[model samples]
Target: MFAFAVGDSLVALDAVKIDTTDQARILRGGQHFQQTCLSCHSLVDFVNDPVAKELGLSKEQMPVWPEDSWNGHPPPDLSLIALSMSPDWLFTYLRTYYVDKARPTGYNNLVYPNTNMPNPFVDMQGHQVLINPNYFDKNHAHGEQFWYRVIKLKETGRLSPAEFDDYVDDIVQFLTYVSDPSVHARRQIGPWVLGYLTLFIMVTYAYFRLVGKDYFQSPKSPPPH
Candidate 1:
């Protein structure tokens, strides 16, 4: 019986330390979305479609890259994904897609069940996937036991698991920021706030120095004594 413990489930990977304030990160994220995620998903003007209406994008403006181009499953609109899903969940899910020859789509995912999206990054990381021998039920025993494993390319892929994970995290963070651009502005203000505090301290110190100069003038009282 393949029973999963609470902790056994794949947790979201930790957030990466990319400069969230970097415009480059956001631009790269958008480009990556266009290249990878847009095939199935639409982020631009996503509001027209009933299913994607909540995204606030109109169909015409929605970024649309057909899935056929990349052998991808239709990607879902991600406009509100950051709001609905945690960053870690998104990061882990992105890293979890793996090849499953037994699957109709030739791929499976731990975060999503029977996903059609094949592991696009598998070529970068060696093929790998979770395996559970006990998960097999005699009647349903095709390859259910291999559920959570992540498979990747043994050699040709461009990134290692850890490196790819960071990539996913970068995308997640960028999306999180996009869902609300205010987040980016708020973060940008952080340094300014610190700078103001430093200036306040300097000004206060100067004011005290000026006061001391007038009040304690060169030991005049000691000379009189």
Candidate 2:
């Protein structure tokens, strides 16, 4: 059994330092998307394709895109994945693909139902799967459990579970940033905009004081009879 806790704050903390601003990270994420996900999923315009016609709607209607890009199946656009899915959900989903003999692809997922994408990062992150005692009950389904007991990596597995989480965080952060590239620039300029507004208010106040001081200070003329 995998000894893991749900409220592990340390794992969350590791993700905080991920540099979404780094150009390298952004480039890597784009590369990863292109190499691993582009064949099936259309990031921008999915509705025009034949698959969308068959599916009755665009890929955006679905929660997430499959790892596999099928010929008949149109891959959904992932541009909005960051906004649509939570960080924790994304993190857990990325780490949850496991081998299941019963599944068509011999794999199953916790975040998604009947997923078709194979684990692209299995070699890097190792394999994990759902461990529900009552596998048949749809409503009472349980969560996943990793094969930490059986599988172990040969090399490049130095990072513990916490470290591995940071790796995923970096990727997720990069994707989130890509989802809205303008946000980074907007946030960077927010303080400057505030500073300019403050300066303008001060200058305007000074001008008003200069113009009105004489009117208030001037001795009141005697009222005309």
Candidate 1 on 170-203: residue-level lDDT in tens? 5776676656666556776999999999999999
TM-score per candidate, in order? Answer: 0.55, 0.57
The clash numbers for all candidates, in the given order, read 23, 2
Scored by lDDT, model 2 comes in at 0.55
CA RMSD of all predictions: 9.0, 9.7
In model 2, which regions exceed 4 Å deviation? 1-42, 45-71, 102-104, 129-139, 142-160, 180-182, 220-225
Query: For residues 70-136, could you state the per-residue lDDT of candidate 2 as single tens digits?
Result: 6334345666666665555566566655666877677665545456666666656665544443544
Give the Å error, residue 163, model 1: 3.1
47 in model 2: Cα distance from truth in Å? 18
Q: Which has the greatest lDDT?
A: 1
- Candidate 1, residue 161: the lDDT equals 60
Query: Which candidate should be chosen as best, given TM-score against the real structure?
Result: 2
**Error of model 2, residue 196, in angstroms:** 2.0
